[model samples]
Target: MSATPDATSAAPDGGFTTVIGPRRSLLAIDLAELWRYRDLVLLLTRRDIVTVYAQTVLGPLWVVLQPLITTFTFALVFGKAAGLAPPGMPGPLFYMSGLVPWFFFSSQVTKTSRTLTGGAHVMTKVYFPRLVMPISTTLSNGFTFLVQLAALAVMVAGYVLAGGLAWSPGPQLLGLPLLVLLMGALGLGTGILISAATTKYRDLSFLVGFGVQLLMYASPVILPLSRLQKFPTLLRVFELNPMTAVIEAFRAMLFGGAVPWGGLTYSAAVTAVMLLVGVMTFNKVERSFADIV
Candidate 1:
């Protein structure tokens, strides 16, 4: 008489398995699970960076070139034509300073907003934390941001050496890392919030691009806050935009401008609330994303 085969060992797949289920807690974020899946996060991030420029002639150079071209275009339209550059700061330098942080924030927001729909295939097949998708996209784009920032630093250094610009970083520059973190938090929070919504309402995905474009104008991107002083109401409204403080802090850090402590504090508070709301919404929606996506 032959022995019966073990039921559990019948299948050939042998690796460890993770059984995912519904989260019990309403505000559960599962940071521990995310940490446990750090390898997967790194893998996904590498894939995002590689696939973004795969088979392209320029490859990663586009990371630096895209911002360079944008800064030049802004210098022409807003600087030469509209004369919107902040006094004493060169147009290209001023624009590049703002564009570096804005590019990172905008790219992360756009990519994270599509995480659920974009990764539906993997989500259906695997049992990893869904939060990894957006987190990895944010991490991958962060690498691109560093590349662009390095190029900006080089240009800024050249301008200083040529006497076209001056350098006077203060104690506020030490807070640059915190400022970057705030920028990422704002983008991730907003993106994940939108991502959860878009899983049900597909049209919301189409609006992300337009919304981000409008947001850029609402912030102090092309024109400095100083230029809008005549319009106190408009400036106050702009201050309400979280990005406005981040951009202002970026400029202040790099160019010896006045740091807006009040605005930054407001932005930080708003960012914390947004992130909490995003995590809750994402947790509630992630359970059914595979079915609808």
Candidate 2:
């Protein structure tokens, strides 16, 4: 009865035709699409975890060793030399409370920032949600974070049992998850932005490692936000860095009795904005990455 052909019919050009259909937004992170590529994501993650430490004598111990060494160095320099409060907290505890998470955040940011360049092979040859590449990088680094966390916990418990540190849970304890999410999101967003840039400017990958080290100093990693507050103008500038609030939130949740809701709120807002910008920029550039990279 109808002159119109079937929607699935081939066109005159000998190609399958796409009929008028409901439009789907391309910018969205389609979880189902990611799920379809779940096997690839898992495989990549496994590969990263296995190969990352390969040929190294210490292997997984490097995870513990890295933070342990940094904690001691910071404790001796910043904690002691600067007359900062190691407080009732032992030196290792004080330093590790900041070190482990900071390492996780920085490592994730650095690795994911090079995701595009590093995965050029998979990108050109495969059809999957591009995000799966970076997500796998993030997930792979999670084991390193877990090991550092376990090491920190053991040290903390030993310090408490030895009467070298005070042990008291606080209302701020509830904000620990929020702090972790805030840091991780900040890393993910920053990494995504840098990754997209690196596809076009390969130098960006090298810059990211040094850039992260500079960011650690800019943050309250080795000091406190309160210390910076002594210089009101300086504190204003420092606050603009998202990690200022994030690291401060870490201290509040660990040592203080309550969360700094204001700081946490600011961190959440900044991370959200960064994530949106990163995703939009990444989507815009991704179409060109295969050709360029």
Candidate 3:
């Protein structure tokens, strides 16, 4: 981030110059500095969303198709053969709820993980806030998530017309924005943490692809949180996953149920800690990224 001169520190020529340099404070972020670079953030975010499918045949259609395909696959494997979905709830609706949020989170971690290593050329040439890289990626993913979420909303509406099945909008829907913030925060925190590490440990860049897949099961994506009850030990482990509550709350908001206040409270705390630690570590490493990456 760049440092601003005080109001009285103008040069004798009466010109104010902002100095671009390394971040000095380990735990404190310069929100004003970050705000000044908001244009760059918006640019990078646009690039992130556009470049992903720029040359692909389907382009943005894949955004809708990917979730639908995965939802049905899970519906077949987990809901039908395994008999996992709660009775009377449509399998597509059940899994789509989880996939919408989970996809946002996983994409954040995957793309932001390469902020330094994959973007070393630009990083070396530029003098913007290092934090800008990850924030743009998170924002771009959030935009894509909104597209997917609209599709999910249509599915929920369809299911409601067919049987209602407690799938109607209510005041609970208001909490959705909070859940989106939590989801983005978790992804941003974890993403930057990995992005910083990947600067020195190049292997993590490759491992992140496999790691997110494994982490999906560790959360309640394919399997509902309730089914884990038989394995009390495993259930305890899954309970600690912050996304469980976020995803569950997301479903409850659409399907009508009580909020998972306990899990969401725990999730907010964990996300706060992870984001703080992630930002501090990222800031501490900013000066060395060019050389190390």
Candidate number with greatest lDDT: 1
RMSD of 1: 5.8
lDDT of each: 0.86, 0.78, 0.85
Decoy 1 TM-score against native: 0.91
What is the full ranking by TM-score, best candidate first? 3, 1, 2
TM-score of each: 0.91, 0.87, 0.92
Clashing pairs in 2: none
Model 1 Cα lDDT, one tens digit per residue, 16-116: 23334544675867676688789999998999989989999999899999989999999999898886766878889989998999999898788899988
Alpha-carbon RMSD to native, per candidate:
5.8, 5.3, 2.6
| lDDT string, candidate 3, 1-293, tens digits | 23565644644434545544554678868788889889999999998889989989999999999999999999998888987765557788888988999999899889888787777899898777788889998899999999999999899888778876565567998989988999999989988888888887888988998988888898877777777778998888888888888888888787777788999999999899889888987887777878775
As for candidate 3, its clashing pairs are none
Q: How accurate is candidate 3 locally (lDDT)?
A: 0.85
Give the per-residue lDDT of model 2 (tens digit) for 1-293: 11223633644434444333334343567676578678988998899988978999999788899999998888888777878865445666767877878887898789888878888897899766789988888788777788888898899788878877687868877877767777888888899999988888888877999989988877777766666757887777777778877776776677665556787788789889879988877877776788896
Question: How many pairs of residues collide in model 2?
Answer: 0
Where does candidate 1 clash, by residue pair?
none
Q: What range of 10 consecutive residues in model 2 has the weakest lDDT sum? A: 1-10
